[model samples]
Target chain A: MAYEQSVYLTGDHELVEEFGLLCYQAGYRVTGTAHPGPVRRKLPVFFRKSTLVPRSATVAMELTNVRTDLKRKNLKFLDGALPKGALLLSSSVTVAAHEQASWIAHPERLIGIAALPTFGGRKLIEMAPAPQTGKDALARSQAFFTRLNKEVAVIQDRVGMVLPRMVCMVINEACFAAGENVATPADIDTAMKLGTNYPSGPIEWANAIGFHQVTAVLEALYRDLGEERYRIAPLLRHFAGGNRWWET
Target chain B: MGTGIAYAAALASMDALLYDVTAEALERGFGKLRADIRQSVEKGKLSPERSEEILSRIRTTGALADLAPCGAVIEAIVEDLAVKQELFRTLSGICASDAILATNTSSLSVTAIASGVSSPERVVGMHFFNPAHIMKLVEIVEGHQTSPDALAAARGLAEAMGKKPVMAKDTPGFIVNRVARPFYGEALRLLGEGVTTAEEIDRIARLEGNFKMGPFELMDLIGIDINFAVTKSMYEQTFGEPRYRPHIIQQQMVHAGLLGRKTKRGFYSYPP
Candidate 1:
């Protein structure tokens, strides 16, 4: 596939760094430095503003922003930068399906993809279409991730996408098990890791991905879905609210 | 009853007195424990020396009075409530004053058992899962009048035995059994609605939901009768909460005695 340019809008240092590397390997012209001032950048191109991208660019990649205050402003910038025929892929941790759908000027051009910045080996992208999203836009979005050799799962748009939603529930259950004293944190982790063959224990995984991100997904589900099963454990809420893990 | 409990108690290094109404029951329990220990040693999970030491600490007797000196007695006998209460009353008089009476009842109410004894304050529920040496969870249930010191002692013993102790307030099914009901109930609901086949549901739960096993398969492994009984208990405890209600399909299977792998038929049929 031939493309004029690929723009990435993200504040996550890990994704920014990893995508910079991915762009280099894929031989695509990458624009946009996270910072306003340049500091020995290695990508083919860098721009501080989203509007600086040329009209010929066919793809725009967006990653999650964890900071609560900057999300709306970042989404506005993303909305303005998307070209008429361009495909918009969001890998946001905090962005919900409704919010993503609403942010696109041409909702038919938007597609949601879930990726964990920490695991850069391969990404799990879940495509969600807004009510106005055209089939052509969805196919182009799917093709883009396919070209990158990324795994994809098409799911209904709720929040946290698929893998993150499922994993968050597992982590929530683990925390509830710990809080109720069903098992020690270590033994529960050990049992799940050994007995169940999970890639990692829920607690350790939460710590690596940041507990706040897990809590955000859970709370969003609880709010959007209005189901008791989605209720966040009290201990998770406590930890996410600034109580240290050891303190609990 | 005696075999699983005796092996668990022995493996925990507790000096256990295995009592039975007859000598045959005592002998059977002891024989099973010895065989289990030998198997563990063969598997390299238990050393031969440690297995012998554990077996030597277990004393088998036919007399109820033989348990008089023990600090805690766990009755892993039949699930009949009347029989358990009668046993508790007898042990209350024979055991020492400070000895904490514990029941290994998994389904019955802990409070009901404690009611049978005169000094109910000393009674606690120490529920260990099957093959207790391996499964790590131990629900430490506190009856209405169970003393703080008694609960503490049970928790301390569980910790010493390398088991994780969780305290439950004498509720039906405790934590794991109660919280885990939806795992089975929801899967059955999906099956009944014709949303997916049993195998597909199992695969989706494992691959998509990340569960170790699907509800139907786990129920089959645990036996349909046992799973149905648990569902009934939770439903009755909660006064027929729709969430924990038993499915009709499960009742039909149990009525037919197609109780999973044990009877070679359940959600799926198996060879005897």
Candidate 2:
């Protein structure tokens, strides 16, 4: 089937690889792929018989761009490179994609989707629209994920979005409990699983999602809302900075 | 008067000296414990001989001095800080210096209570949930000066009682109370904001959020007065953080003495 929109992706994780492969299979053009450096060569254009193919898709995977300065520069380079109406989808946890949407030729065409590299088997895709994103952009975002056989849940434009937000809050509470020795990590997880039937105890969830990401969400929530309830636990903050209490 | 804590304490084979300011309170507590043991024996939950042995381990006393010889003393007294401090002050002087002085205070600051004692190092908060014998989580709180050995001993004792011990630093509401605040506060805020009714909020939390009980129902069971007191303590301890702020609706309910099932009136009406 012929595709109507071109999608550009940025991220080097498993989600990026899977999403790029899905886009290719779904008849979208793979205009360029960049990891840590600039795409220095022209992208290969696949053509069908007797006519010039309308190359509508431009998917770029920028996963290795970790430094904030380099990331900002790379995003600017991508913004200048994509054709008009090209959709920019970001799957990076460090940089909120919506923040860079305005720099594009069509600001309203950009949407941010939370990406899970490991748990990508689940069909649920959390979609958040940037402040400048229009209705068409939102629909395109939904359709893009839908094409990949993913179900989408739309949420407010906030760091961590919905599931991550709710899950992070639970983890934050659990960390506070663990920090205080309210219960051993094993028992805390056990009580939640046994007593309340949570999918995973907060500590295990933190370990799975990476403590830094959890701490970032908490710190963001605290900073944005200035609420003490969202204050990052000392243990979580310490872990984010690669420190453990037991070592000290 | 509750049978759970006393029965579990007896089952753990710790010599329990149940004390109250009045003899009637002690009698009621002991009677309830005895009835529970008898039922266990009849149901084969405990052998008749073991039931007798369990009963032998618990002694009732009105005098504070009776707690002196005990290796560890858990004060499940009234929640008032002044009263708790006074009791601890008395217990500190009466009990052996080596004995671990523990308060079963769920909401009050363990640090504040420890501060009242000459040997704050010996003071620790051993917060057991209501129906303590049934609830498995025991918060073992360490005050600023609480010795590592003291904390370890408290943890060991909690395990000895077959309770899961979680370490918590001395903070308002400690872990459970502090972390669990939003469960009630957000529900009340939803009520005040007119986002949802009390019944609907409770229903959503149970059905959607997967809480066993809604905030309002749990508040009623815990008593409006007690819940309000905990919220106020957390707010005050956090220097009046807005997130932990107490709602006026709860304060009004307490003023009305609609303290849930105990008073037969709260968020819902109950028949006595």
Candidate 3:
């Protein structure tokens, strides 16, 4: 939502790099990088909740898949003084716009968006407006993104809206099979594409969407929906913690 | 299914003996083969002489004993573990000792099916997708007791029949079925929860993800009953792993006789 300040993302330095490149391709100015994310390739010493909204951002885009992080950190920071109607477009993958609205003071300004890295470059973007989300806020947000050349579809507010939930859950199942050695990841990907006409293999999707974000979706779904179906696979959690993906 | 396999074999210049349990079943298989060959000839994909030659190379039989001379026997029968195992056991007894006993099962465990067969080492899974001669993918699965020679033989046959062969272990759902579960499972879950309409999900799936069909659309195309059965089979086989759980909506759809395009109703209705 905040086009003025640089968009915040989740991945380490690589995530920052990819997001920056993608932003540039979309004709947005790649401003300056914020803090370089934590370095990996070794055991994590501690868990971190990502820092929240920047003070000066006119549009605060919450681009995270984890609801807990979105609550305790990001939206939590926008408390009391959120610059009077500063548009907050939270990622609606794990939590619905209506639910995320409950956490903020002015629920009218917040809109839910279903976005994932794997969903990049699509002409349409799915958005869910909280019942309290102001009509002006929705129109302005649409106009802003439309100027950026992306069309938005407004769907009913629900957890994991549509695309993100479906795609990420598919990736999670692929990880279960790969972890169990049911088949090699490459073979699993190949079979799905050739056998079922999948646009892309789930393993390849995991890499594109980032394992950590995928795990975040499962975690949030499990916490909110309370079903074993949303439980994260151990292998996927390991990859997320390590910022690793299955090798092609 | 056997008719497709026989068509694929004969098309590959290999002699094929199509077997079934009854004269009526054999006639149905023969009818499909004739229609397929006729279509190919009409499309100019095959010359009349060549189509006749391919047809001549495929012989039909009602008795398992007639397959004794074949080097391989692919069973594309029912999906029940018990039924598949029983059929394989009969074929194992009737076919030659070295014959590759392959099951074209999509959901049953190749290992469990092989467990009851004679010379289990010779049993492998040659999982060809529907319309075997058309779909290019063939999963060559190795059961726990399947020998390397049998695996290689199945793989070799798949390649010779112009299908891409991928190897998998004797796991529930194997490769494609297991990996592809979420496409339908998650869609069904969303639908059951009234998160979005089936048409909306299919549109987003195609437009956003570039998938050819959305989970709901694909499920409708693949009978809701068939897709539901695969999910339930994987769930039970995996000891009720939540990820593979079948949704109540699909079960209800099956009960209502809204199978899919075949039944004129499913996730979406098909006009008769």
TM per prediction:
0.68, 0.64, 0.87
Highest DockQ against the true fold, candidate: 3
**Model 3 global lDDT (CA atoms, 0 to 1):** 0.78
* 2 or 3, greater by lDDT: 3
* Tens-digit per-residue lDDT, B115-209, candidate 2: 77988899998877766766777778888889998899999998998888877777777666766666677667547755446776555445434
- Residue-level lDDT tens digits of model 3 in B83-183: 88888888888888888999999988888998867689999999999888788899999999999999999999889888899999999889888888888
User: Model 2, residue B258: displacement in angstroms?
Assistant: 6.1
Model 2: DockQ against the native? 0.13
CAPRI level of candidate 2: incorrect
Residues A105-182, candidate 3: write the lDDT tens digits.
788998987766646577677888999999999997897567546777778887777888888887888888888888
What would the per-residue lDDT of candidate 1 be over residues B87-153, giving only the tens digit for each residue? 9999999999899999888788888988869889889998887777676767788888999999998
> What ranking emerges by lDDT with the best candidate at the front?
3, 1, 2
> Which is better, 1 or 3, measured by TM-score?
3
Tens-digit lDDT string for candidate 1 (A133-239)? 78898888777666666555565554655456656776787677677665566655655554434556777877766666678777766676576666787778777
Ranking by TM-score: 3, 1, 2
Deviation of model 3 at B268, angstroms: 1.6
